[model samples]
Target: MQFLSAYAAALIVFGILDAVWLSIMGRLLYRPTLGSLMLDNLRWAPALVFYFLFPVGVVHFAVLPAFAAGSLQTALVNGGFLGLLAYATYDLTNYATLRVWTLTLTLVDVVYGAAATAIVAGGAYGALRVLASAGWI
Candidate 1:
């Protein structure tokens, strides 16, 4: 459980940092095309894991603060970011949905942490219990 909590927090923090960075970059260069959006930018939306992780990270870091600060071109990209983040976050959020039966932002990280702990502990306990009953040394 402790390990799960730590790993999950790390993952979320990494995500927040990546988003802030993307939003920042998106606000900066104002790339003319997604083609030149950035390396690995918006490249893989289809992949369930790590999809939009790169592009979204770039766009989030680039655009978010600008939007909060009331910048012009910054807000324009919000729609695009929303589309990407929605899907990407959805993919990432799915990590927890299976266990808790809910898919809200709150459960996104919670489920991941809980599931990890449950899986690890369950496995270990099952193995130990079986070993003990079997009289194995």
Candidate 2:
């Protein structure tokens, strides 16, 4: 029950944050930068897979550990590092292999990924703490 609650919290937080980020940055940054490479319609299958799976990684790598340690800082730092590594892998690979990929996009996305993941992880941890305190979880 506790694990499910934590996972749900992390998933909800991460999905909301990432959706907002994509909605905003897809116009302001990605579309402008990637232009033709930007698909008119999103590929939902892979996107859904990523959204679902990413939170599991977050819960396992960041939230669970921090919850055990009873330290929000642990969640934030570990989440950020995980985000950095994941985003950097994608962005750097694209920059290296794709002609359309740019340094600006890579840098912005990498930073956003780290920040967003940190926020999501911390938010989930905090929510769990609140629930536990309230005897809800």
Candidate 3:
């Protein structure tokens, strides 16, 4: 039950933050740079897969460890590092292989990923703590 609560909190936080980021950046950033490569419509299946699975990664890698250590700082730092690695994997690979992938985009995305993941992990950890205190989780 505790694990599920943590996972759920992480998923919700990550999903909300990522959705807002994507919606805002889709025009200001991605469209200007990667518009040519952009699909007319989103492919939801892969996106859903990523959204669902990434939070599990966060719960396992960041939230649980932070809980074990009883430190929110652990969540933020580990989550940020995980985000850096994960986003760098995608952005760097694209920058390496795709002619359209700009260095600016890669750098911005990697930074965003790190910051966003840190926020998500911290938010989830905080939420779990509050819920536990309230005897809700």
Q: Write the per-residue lDDT of candidate 1 for residues 94-128, one digit (tens) a residue.
A: 54554432345334334443333233223333333
Q: Model 2 residue 10 lDDT?
A: 88
**What is the C-alpha lDDT profile of model 2 across 59-94, one tens digit per residue?**
899998999999999999999999999999999999
Model 1, which residues run further than 4 Å from truth? 29-48, 51-137
Report the C-alpha displacement of residue 83, candidate 3, in angstroms: 0.4
> TM-score for model 1?
0.27
For candidate 1, the per-residue lDDT at 111 reads 41
Model 3 lDDT tens row, 6-125? 888888888889889989999999999997899989999999999989988888999889988989999999999999999999999999999989999999999999999998889888
Worst 10 residues of 2 by lDDT: 1-10
Error of 2 at 38 (Å): 1.5
Per-candidate alpha-carbon RMSD to the true structure:
19.7, 0.9, 0.9
The stretch of ten residues in a row with the least summed lDDT in candidate 3 is: 1-10
| TM-score between model 2 and native | 0.96
**Model 2, global lDDT:** 0.93
**Models ranked on lDDT:** 2, 3, 1
Clashes of each: 19, 0, 0
TM-score of each: 0.27, 0.96, 0.96
Task: Give all candidates' CA lDDT scores.
Answer: 0.39, 0.93, 0.91
lDDT of 2 at 132: 89
